[model samples]
Target: MSKRGGSRNPSSERARGRDREERREREREREREREREREKRERERETEREREREREREREIEREREIESEREREREREREREREREGERGREGERHWKNRREGHDGEKSGVCVCACTRERERERERERERERERERERERERERERGRERE
Candidate 1:
């Protein structure tokens, strides 16, 4: 039988080339999409890690503030107990001085009053310092939050 057309026809060759080019284009598109997906996943993971870090920092700061508050409260309780003792001592000495008018008892009362005043002033200073620290922490927190855009 005579072959009507050879297997290597020019039109068939052009069509096969076009098919191969089309397949290559589709493969390139798929690769680009996969790369984009991978990049998106990486960015998501990075964001999650950054969020975890910020949360840890916040937790640490809270713990530190709580610890400081506990220490301050302990100091306050101790000061109150000391003040009560001083008051009781002053009253006892006053009664004794009224019985005999001792100059030494009067000097002791003066010293206790001075110490009490000093303690009150120190307490006020400490409160002011604590307030300043809290304000600074708040400002820092605000800055941090503003810098990080939440997801």
Candidate 2:
């Protein structure tokens, strides 16, 4: 089998060169795919880290809110206790004032009764002196008047 109508059989050389070029192109394509896969993996890791940080921040905020609520409740309880103490003191003071007023009224009434008794005694003395002066002026009738007075 002789090569037909070919000066140098250049077809074989051209075919080999084309095959080598195709192999090189295939290798470049595979390398590009591997680089894309690596980039995707790095992006996924970054996203996971960001999500974890956000969750931690949310937990911290929740703790702060709980602490603030507890503080407010404690303050309210303290205020209520103070108010109760004040009410008790006020009631005791009112009772003491009422007792003082009652004692003063009783003392005033006793003094008034004493004054009335003294006035009555003075009036009786003045009436007895007037009767004695009238009896001296009528000595004849003094004995009969004295008997009448005794009866």
- Which predicted model would earn the best TM-score? 1
lDDT (Cα, 0-100) at 6 in candidate 2: 59
- Please report how far candidate 1 places residue 74 from its true position, in Å: 0.8
| Residue 96 displacement in candidate 1 (angstroms) | 10
Off by over 4 Å in 2: 1-9, 89-151
lDDT of 1 by residue, 1-151 (tens): 6556746678988999999999999999999999999999999999999999999999999999999999999999999888788874576556544444235545433333344556888999999999999999999999899889663
Q: Where's the lowest-lDDT run of ten residues in candidate 1?
A: 107-116
* Tens-digit per-residue lDDT, 19-102, candidate 2: 999999999999999999999999999999899999999999999999999999999999888777776256544444344423
- Where does candidate 1 stray beyond 4 Å? 1-7, 89-151
Error of 2 at 88 (Å): 2.4
Error of 1 at 124 (Å): 31
